[model samples]
Target: MTIIRNIFHGFLRAMSSNSKIPIAPVGVRGMRDLDRTKFSLNVILPVLKVREEKLSKISNILKQYFLKLENFKPVQAQDAVTKCVYFNPEKITQWNEFSEKDKSIFQEHNIDHTSFSLQSVQLSYDNFKIDTIFKAVLPENEETVSGFSQIGHIIHLNLREHLHEYRHLIGQVLLDKIKTCKTVVNKSNIIDNTYRNFKMEVVAGTEDYFVTVKENRCNFQFDFSKVYWNPRLGKEHERILSFLNPNDVLFDVFCGVGPFAVPAARRKCTVFANDLNPDSFKWLNHNAKHNKVNMNIFRSYNLDGKDFICDIFQKFVSNICDGTEKLKEGAKIHVTMNLPAMAVEFLKHFNGLLRNKENTVHVEIIAYVYCFAIGDDPASVAKKMVSDNIGRDISTSILDVFNVRNVSPKKEMMRATIRLNDVIFNELQEPPTKKVCV
Candidate 1:
């Protein structure tokens, strides 16, 4: 047994050093020597040296076995330290011979255990091998278990080599069924094209709103119409709306599909939503109708090109202030924009918007920085954009940047809030040097 333990340990150590098996034994467990002839010839080996490298192989094999399974990607490997069941010839035979009826009986009883010879053995595989077996049991409610039984052999193989694969398969099977059983409620009929040429679904009794189908972009939803703006200025909308009193004026620069405007209108706040995209402008008007709110939609473009600071200032003066008439004296304007990476660049233009205003207007300029996670530190990509674009104009002291929730897994989208004091400004300078009222 001691010799066998050393041999097993050595084999495992060598394999761990050479391969990328995710599972590794931390401490020595009891080991025993069994007849070398007892090993089954049908055992399939994992070809890949690393766990991630084997993903494609596993996907291909699973696809081959289950034709309906598409886009099968591995997420996380299950821990299999104490879960592995070593088997002798008799136990293997019993598993192989398990009838559909027998499998159903075991499932009906929710049995998760298997009786087999207990021994710790080290397994080795070639790095070039790509595919490994995965196994799962059929549900007890399954009428015809042949489909499951056919895959049982593969499952058994995975169980012997990588118990994590077996566990993953089981979870996948259950999740698939649950997902399939879900009833997709039809909200497509509620789509109204009277205001905009788009599809909208209002999940009844919830503030959640969804917009359908954008080119190179998936359908998106927001929590509130006022703050939960989508595409860019979602978080800013939420913050401004949180503090907005009823009937307050909200201005959204480059507002897409009324994420900020619609919610503000729903809250009975006057909203002026503007966007450069013709489609977005159309959708904004349509979303207002869908939500049964009166939101002013404006089609305006920031001609500033890459110089967002100059562009934003010009847009505010030419379009938002003059064209929309929403930036009136004493009117509190909650300005929302989905360009966090470029928000600071646009701050220098804020002085011009507040200039000549009698009543102190609140300007909430939102800069959404797409991050990997909700609370993760801003990645280099976003920080670089801020530094490259807005570094010279303003320091961090004058800017109010709040992290919004994570919008994507790639950290490509995040929302940051910038609240500006609505102090009256008399002139717009190349460098903004206007006093702001807190």
Candidate 2:
């Protein structure tokens, strides 16, 4: 009886071992995790050695059918033979369909493909799965893929702890696949809890840290590894700028590299931008010039938002209302505290922030505070927290609440646009004003 039981168990183990496994989930929509196969029909057209300069002129002919697989590289310095790869091996008919314009471009540039060689070559790809051109250098388990930051010409990956071993391969793949990415790096320790910068390891490509990028018709250039910059806030910055007019004043208490300030300045709104990071201060000044914003109207400061509000921000408001009464207040002055982690606490400064202590000023001061909250209802959680910190009953005066993005499984980042009540300006008489926000 024991021998029969043992034989049955062995049979069950064999069956389990032979069972087919399920396919792994594709974590991100754009990620390619499969292997790429070599196709024999891949096009390989080598331009004539003498007329290589004409390659660019005729390349558009190829782009009509195939994606560019490889950039031009010197085949031989002596013969001046250069070659570029067109990704399409399947579009051979397009080559025959070439127009006279293409031939004329070839004729004008003296390019000919007479000595071209066509052959099958296995395109080297790191992924083991089929049909994937570029595979992420995944962890040993291949499950978690974190988001990355593209700074200028660099792509910075904040990989999980398990992905360190494959960092180099991943960096190399990114450099090869991302035409604009000259350098790929793995960021360790993340943005410092206090300093807000990361330790970077360059896994592949150039080591240059300086980068240039454009957002909302504004150009920004900065050090990718040293400074803090988030492309995700491009729209948020624009949204705030859209609310302000040319004659208004903007106080970007935590402005990093003028992402918010430069555009506001361009809109003709005088801007007083400040940051705790010196790099951000320098770059903010640089971007102000880079964007051709009027320097006369823009100010950059290296200070914590808490101090900045007390000094530069106060001076800005004082100068704005130096002659004019505080009648048109809320519509004219705007304060943006964007450090989501600390912005809510910064609201305490507004408890007794402004002077003039009137029941209703000409216009009220509008504060846009960004915060991160974790709960089933992030808006209510953040709204309550904002109310408690500022000492005002949020039963009224919370103008607009925006859910920025989901940072994690349960945590969300949000923005609350609140009109400063008279109660916030030194606990004065709370009087009702126009409900409409300009």
Candidate 3:
């Protein structure tokens, strides 16, 4: 009998060391009815009956050991007649575990240190967190789906093929856990190159696509289905904006809904924003107007990227040379090409387009070109591609090469900043001296 008692105490000690509170009930895999799927966790906790008014004071004194079970109060009615404050079982199982300081505090407060009684508390499904639910339902070896992009009221997920069967469950869990989420969608296909927007299927919640997002101190409103926007690029946008000053000139060649152009205009910089997609162009004008930047400050165009580049630069050069447009002293010119798939192909247009020895002597032009490259070193590969496309060695003129983001395990999205000065633009040859009369 004594041996059996010792073995039982040993088992209790092991359980006390390894047991976790609020554990989910088993056999709920592939279950879709979230509320009806009940889970219960029964734990033997230490309970102390106290007067109703001392509940708050005792709770504060024992805050570190206060019960953390969700949707249940730590202080509750013990029976039809009394109230008690419960302590987390994982923290203490006996009266001797309390420190001398805690004992003295309890004595000073007229509370008996030996008054704790072991009581069984039952926690239900509402007690578990989202990660606990996912772990309880997902296979032991399977990957958990937790990463998502939240844009306004929508949550965007890129679930793997293995998670397809659990898509609805995953979306429902996200919607239920995230307070601000009103809709959840998954990418149904790859992004279309021309429009840069992907087809998505609503997995849960309302199917509203029109939303407004705030970034870089600017508000942008657009239909998620008609335009392309990545919240991950917010830091990248701010990094580029940090390079510009007020009254500078910015040319956003492939501006999608004027993410860069609108902010630049707000900075007091003159902006020329263009896009090929009609929806993007319309929204660009709308966003500029909504931001209170007039057409005079932020120009909009729907021309192709190449055509826009050529037309804008030529007009700019002509304006500078002929004095039709005046630039503020020390103002710089910036060109942003953000179509990562094929922006390098458009670099040749600026080879000789802005070369004017007399007019552009004091002008400084900077070009930020984004592209995708696959190699061990994607930044070097991107720089080499930019040099090859422009028909010159831009190694020295290249100011910065940044890894904007990774598109895949092997492919990377990179940005190369190139200085376009007299060296980059072909210098015009001097006409032969005429000496016919002499």
TM-score of 2: 0.67
Residue 116's lDDT in candidate 1: 17
The CA lDDT of each predicted structure is 0.37, 0.67, 0.80
Query: For this target, which candidate reaches the highest TM-score against the unseen true structure?
Result: 3
lDDT of 3 by residue, 2-102 (tens): 96557557545755576534435567776655653456665566778776666666666677877876677877886765678787767765566778887
The digit string of per-residue lDDT tens for model 2 on 15-129 reads 3454321212233224323223321122222222333565565666655544333432323243445554433333332222346776666667655455232332232332122
Worst 10 residues of 1 by lDDT: 149-158
Off by over 4 Å in 3: 1-13, 16-22, 32-36, 40-119, 355-361, 373-376, 406-412, 422-424, 427-438
Q: Write the per-residue lDDT of candidate 1 for residues 1-438, one digit (tens) a residue.
A: 898667556545544455422322222212122122222222212211113433353343223222111232223233432222222221222232345665455445343235211233233221101112111122223221122211101111112222222333333332233322211111223213322222322211222233232211122232222221233343445565676666455556656565556666667666555665455655566656655564343323422323333454334534443446444444454556554434445544554444554433234333332222223455434444443443332224235344564444545454434334421143223665789999
> Is candidate 2 or 3 superior in TM-score?
3
Q: Indicate which candidate wins on lDDT.
A: 3
Tell me the TM-score of each prediction against the true structure.
0.37, 0.67, 0.80
What lDDT score goes with residue 299 in model 2? 82
Provide C-alpha RMSD values for all models, in order: 18.5, 13.1, 5.6
